[model samples]
Target chain A: MAIPLIQFINVSKNFGESHVLKGLNLSIYKGEITAVIGKSGTGKSVLLKHIIGLVQQDSGQILIEGQPLSQLSPKKIKLFYQKLSYMFQDNALFDFMNIYDNIALPLVENSRFPKDQVNKKVLKRMDQLGLIDIEKKFPSQLSGGMRKRVALARALVMDPEIVLFDEPTTGLDPIRKKKVHSMIQEYQKKFEFTAVIVSHDIPEIFNVVQRIALLDDGIIKFEGTKKDILDSQSKILNDFIAGKDI
Target chain B: MLNKLIEKFGEKTINLLKSFGRIILFCFSGVTNIFTLPFQFAKIIEHMWFIGTKSIFVIILTGLFTGMVLGLQGYYSLVKVGSEAALGAAVSLTLISELGPVFTAIMVTARAGSSMAAEIGVMRISEQIDALKTMHINPVRFLFSPRIIAAAISFPLLTALFDVVGIFGGFISGSMMLGINKHVYMDTVIQSVKIHDINVGFYKAFAFALVTTTICCYRGYYTHLYSGFGARGVSLSTTNAVVHSCIAIFIFDYIITFFWV
Candidate 1:
């Protein structure tokens, strides 16, 4: 088998008496979409954060392309983060910034791009995401779906090596969710970067993802292709697929 | 019972020491990042606008009224002692050496200090700080250094402005109202004032600015480390920041002034 693009080795995290992640191990390959589907509060988002160094695990380790993230120097870590991007669940857009500046931030902050080029890049991404002429509007002025799209635009504007989406389609309507799923597919096809999406939106996300990892009790209880998950005899996987809690 | 009291006292002392250590460390990190790679000129300018320009009007009003009051009281007392001509010395000395920096700092603590806390507190609660971190931007450099630098720079200037405006206020009340000649009053002020007094006021102002901003920023920046009340947490941080800034201002003022005395 090929070397895994990202690896979690027996990682554990605890908040006081409660353990959020308990010796979880998983591997993600390059150029693939892997959706971590689990019930709310199962440490799915925590695992995604560890990948990008947002949150640290209490034990074990996380490796990105065979380089241990915990061991990287500050300079190297920042340089590493330039190649990785995360789209927050809150859209985390600066409230004071307009949509254009919001989308333009990751580029402008990380690089010394000229004003006109920055504008062009931001406008291009906005157009690709169907966010035309709304540059002057603040995040507060935009609807939830529009805000998420603007946030995603900021994430992709960097053209990173790995893109992590946290609950990408959580609050959107069915049509908006469908539109977002299509956008992800379209962009993933164009960019071909590794994608790890943390979501509880199960069957809805299943069709859009190539692989599925079922997280339960702070561990990856099941990991395989959608067909394998569907054909498996695991009670938890079956309950998850049938929209019932186990 | 006495042992319990002693034990409780020891625990409280350790906790207080830890908090002080934390603030010093936070200040160290913030100051170091401010001088580190790629300083932000634009954000610094914006912060100066917020901390300096927006604060001038209220400082002017307070300075003028305070000077006038000092002038009125001083003129009355001097007239009783048949030393009404000494009114200029009293007003200028008090305004420059003591009240000017102290009042200006208190006003700013109420105005800009609390707002800085609220702004950073909101950013912390909302995860904008995390967003900056993920984008490889240091939150201390990007969010903090500018405001701290702005307050330090603006406080001394505002204290000087307060001194000037207050002298004019005293001039009006002492000369125009109490019938002391403008020329004699001006001469008295020029003669009585020394450069050391003004310098001391500014040094104190600079020190107070650093203290107030550091306390407010540290308190607000670490709101998440406080109890998790979500919106309530940010609000509490803001309130505590303002309160702490005031307390730190007085404590540092005494410490700095004690050295002078």
Candidate 2:
């Protein structure tokens, strides 16, 4: 098999008495859009976090581009982190910064991109993301959808090899949701970057995501194409697919 | 019962040591990157403006009132011994040696330090810090070092301002109000106020700045890890940051004074 772009090797995580991930093993191939679907409070976000080393596994390891995340030293970890970008559920844009500066932060801070270049890059990203007339506006000034787009612009400005989206369509209206999903699909098609999205918007994302991983009881119960999940014999998986909490 | 008590004591002791070790490690990390490459000159300027320049009004007001009170109180006490001439010496010494640095630090801990904690705590909860990490930026170096360095630079200057304003206030209260020989009071203050006294105050101010900023930043940075998340967590961190900064400032002030004096 082709080497996995992202790998969770029997990972386990516990938040006090709550075990979020238990010996969970999953892999994402390069240039593929993988959707991680599970009930709320499952470790889907936690798994995304582990990919970026924002959180650690209590047992086992996560690997990005074949390098184990846990084994990397702090210096190496930072270097490794530049390869992946996480688009948070809340957008997590700095409210203090305008759209331009917010998008340019990673570039400016990490790459120390020059002022003129930073301006050009930020403007280009904003234009591509259809964020016009909002460059100077702060995150608080924008609508939720606009803020999400600005955050996507920020994440895309860095242009990492992998982008993890946490609930990409959680709070958007249908039009905005389709807009976001289409943007993700178009971006993934163009950039060919590995995309792992943790989302609750069911069959809606079915058309956008190529593969689906069903997380149940802290373990991935099913990993297959959307068609395979649709045809699965597992009643719990079916229950979840039918939008029922098991 | 005895075994359980021992177990509880051991657990608490271990937790304390763990927290102490983490603080030390965080401080070391901060110190390592403080003067390193990619120094945040703009951020430091912004923080200095926030922590120092903007705080002038309050510092001036506090200094004026504190000095006036000291002068008024010192005159009555010194007059009982018929040593009213020593009132200037008392006010200047009290300010230059202790009150200037301590009170200025306490004020900063309340204003800038608490706000810094709250800001970072909110960032932690909102995952802005995590966003920074994903971008390969050291959140501590980016979010914290500037504030710490600014506090270190601003504290001494503010203390100096406090000292000067306070002396003027004392002048207003003493020579202007108490009917003392104005020239004598001025002369005593000018002659008796040695550089050692001012030096000690500046040194203590620097120490207090480090204590306040470090503790406050630590509280904010680890609030999510130690406490929890959301508004309640941020509020707790802000409160704890101010209280802890005050406690640390007082303890360090005593320790530094004992050793230096």
Candidate 3:
């Protein structure tokens, strides 16, 4: 009954001859973790990009907090970006900047926060992620898990209302993946912000997300509770569940 | 085969026009971006380190050797004309007016421009540019403007350095090697080269700097618009930046000459 925080209304996108997204309609509520599961190259990342205005839809509308994103000018779109944050799959921290500066960059660039305040916020986030000791380390110096954690900390530095994760659990060992999954759960619980995760790692994401959306052939085939996804009888869903088709 | 060839050529021509149009847009946006953030002195200083200080050694080496070669060649030509004392004027004029800025930009294109394309292209593919946008940071103001401002400021100074060193090279060749009277050689240069020539050279250098930096940054910034091998995309952009910079420098040089003459 509540107004959804983000909504995609008949959204579609095409890259040349290939249609990546086709009339995809979905809505995400505030303070909920919604996991989008799909095979590789199923336009999961492309869908996430549209939420943040990185990629534009060819048709339909993307609404953030009920305001149409497609109708906004570039300047207004940029203003809307302050409320949303995206953590890239590869944890694309600027290699040239140290971890502290990487996390402090948004604050220094956008907000009126003084240097000392920025440093203090960065240090606090570093401490929260148990990365206080690695403040001076560059992205090249950190391990894969450490880099993702640092990136997540940076994403949360501005305390955005929504966070989108692109394959957050990829390239991690089982234990590290579990840790990352729990970290997502922990952040969601603490902040009560909207979280949309795009991943193929179903089991890990299933534990955190309340609803699962399965995408195939440029369409959302199913959208329901995690139990509905587990007990799905749809051939496409079964094929995805058995890992028989991508 | 004929149809395929025509199609390919047509595509290339369209692409060329598109590139030209994009560059005009980039220049307009760059001007607006500078006005929007007129107090970005710290960023300008930071990019001075990247675009100026980082390329200093290459610029100096290219300038010195170019001067040395010009001195050697000009001396031989002047001797044939029985005007060996005019070596200084010839070397200084050529180096300052053409070789100094153009060669410096080309060398930088090979070094810094290629690296910049690679760095920014990788960032584009990786979605780092998107991250900047999500944080409400304008990539043009944060990334591109500093490099443009830095190169514009440094190119003229480097051209001056090149001119002085080149004339010194000519001085050594004429007086020491060819045994021309040192006083006469110096007097010939001082009399033949007017201050207007120096002013024109600096103006041309400034224009060259703007062209080179704008092209390189534009290529790197929009590299993702092209497909296929990412490395190949970067390689093509680097080549385009260098070729376009050279052609633009010469074309602008002719226009300036037309007016100055």
When 1 and 3 are scored with lDDT, the better candidate is: 1
The candidate, 2 or 3, that scores higher on lDDT is 2
Task: State the lDDT of candidate 1 residue by residue for B43-68, as single tens digits.
Answer: 88888888889999999999999999
The best-first sequence of candidates by DockQ reads 2, 3, 1
DockQ of each: 0.74, 0.87, 0.78
lDDT tens digits by residue: candidate 3, A1-246: 777788888899999999999999888888999989888888989999998878889998988778887677888776667779998988889988999889999998876888889988889988877797887889999988889888888888988878999988777788878877887889789988789999888666789898788887788888877789778788887777678865
In angstroms, the error of model 1 at B43 is: 1.5
Pairs that collide, model 2: none
Tens digits of per-residue lDDT for model 2, A1-246: 788878888999999999999999998998899999999888899988888777888999788668887677888776666778889999899987888889999888866677888889888989988899887888998888888888888888877788999997777889989988998999899989889999888888888888899998999998988879778898888999887778
Candidate 3: C-alpha lDDT:
0.80
Model 3 regions more than 4 Å off = A65-67, A71-79, A230-235, B1-14, B227-229
**lDDT of each prediction vs. the true structure?**
0.87, 0.89, 0.80
lDDT order, best first, reads: 2, 1, 3
Question: Model 1: runs farther than 4 Å from truth?
Answer: A72-76, B1-11, B227-229
Which candidate number would show the highest DockQ if scored against the true structure?
2
Residue B131 lDDT (model 1): 85
CA error at residue A191 for candidate 1, angstroms = 1.6
